[model samples]
Target: MSGQRKNPQARDRTIGAQLKALRQEQTTLNLEAAARAIGWSTATLSRIENGKRHITSEDVAMVLTTYGVPMAQREELIESARTGVQAGWWSRPLPGVLPDVGTLASYEASARAITDWSFSFIPGLLQTERYAAGLMSEDGAEPLEVTMRWRARLQRQRVLPTIDYTAFLHESALQQPFGGVDALREQLSHLVQASTRGLGVRIVRGRVPHRLLLHPWLLLDFPDAPPVLNVELNGSSVFLHDDEVRSYDNMRSMLDGMALSSAESRSMIGQLRERL
Candidate 1:
């Protein structure tokens, strides 16, 4: 599991991207000239620029010196290099869950906002412990594994109050009796409470044709970086970035136009809870 888990590479990638941008904007020299000046092979510099490999503080110092980076603009890069080597909480191990779970956690840590589209089940961020345990038990995960997974998920939920979270849930999903009727009622009530705090739980009401709705996706937006769209496939994940996220943007816009108003959504959820 540890072998499959993503390391603290996201920060390295972010730093590398910043370095590449700085080198391009601050210096007239291209990669070849910069590599020669820094006494590194062109391929090594390319890997560092593309975030395919990590760079040490000395390497950063060398690049900064070669680029003649102003002292004022050098602190952030030095700090990024120093901190990128540290491991994050996402590195915690889980028995049966995919190592990519760590990858999602890293993204969540940096995201300024998250928009989740759930077609068949409740989004994990908004799930109650009982609800989560109920859902996970069916996977044949061991008791300890279930506890660990739920604990990690609950910890991740702490970010909801600090960040913008808008959940687009299918009406059918909100009505399903997951974890039985009683647990489902609890989950609905929890959603109501969460919305009052910061979570936006909007119900997607229209019965669009099967061909119209795309696969479920989670879009994470960062204040400094590009948005990422994560789509789960057969229990694994696909992370779409850069130009690829535009199509997802289109789908999000279509859904946004059709989703119920927040007030109406809250009322709808209240009514569902009352029926239970």
Candidate 2:
């Protein structure tokens, strides 16, 4: 092993993106020129800038200094890089769960805005413990793994209060009670109260049709970096950046056009909860 990390973690990606953005805005030099200023090969710099390789806080300092960023400005970014590399709970391995799970959590934590589009089930961020547990159990995860996964999920949800968060859920999602009737009822009640807690939960009435509504995805917008699109699969996730994120961006706008207002969604959820 070269002792270099691949599939760069979220912190590394964020740091790299910030540096790339700074390079673009703060300097006229091209990538090759900028890399030369830092004594790095163009290819090495490109990989770091595009988040394909791991980077250190020291690397961030060097890049920013090369770009002539003010010391005050550089300090905050350097600190962010320092703290970001520290391992969180998601750093540990969980059997039956992929590393992207942790990566997704890291992205969510750093995002300034988060939008979740769900079709077949409730988004994990808004799921109740029992509800989440039921889905995990149904997926054939071991009981211990279910416990670990939900705990990590709950931790990820902590970021909601700190960011602009919205969940666009299909009417079909409200219909499926993963954790049984009573659990689903509580989950719906939770959704009704979500807005009060600063979460936007919009219901996309199932009758409305769109090709982009085929699967679930989370769009994470960063303060200094490009938006990342996270699509969770069976036990893995696919992250899209740059041009690949365009369709999902359009999908969000489409949902905004068609989904019910927050008040209407609360009422709908309340009604559903009553019947249950």
Candidate No. with top lDDT: 2
Clashes of each: 0, 0
Which parts of model 2 have CA positions greater than 4 angstroms off? 1-7, 21-44, 58-80, 92-97, 208-210
Residue pairs of candidate 2 with colliding backbone atoms: none
The sequence of per-residue lDDT tens digits that candidate 1 reaches over residues 76-122 is 78877777655566656566666667677777877899998888778
Query: Residue 242 lDDT in model 2?
Result: 82
lDDT of 1: 0.77
Give the clash count for model 2.
Answer: 0
The lDDT for every candidate, in the order shown, is: 0.77, 0.84
Instruction: Tell me how far the alpha carbon of residue 153 in candidate 1 is from the true structure, in angstroms, after superposition.
Output: 0.9
What TM-score does model 2 achieve against the real structure? 0.84
RMSD of 1: 3.9
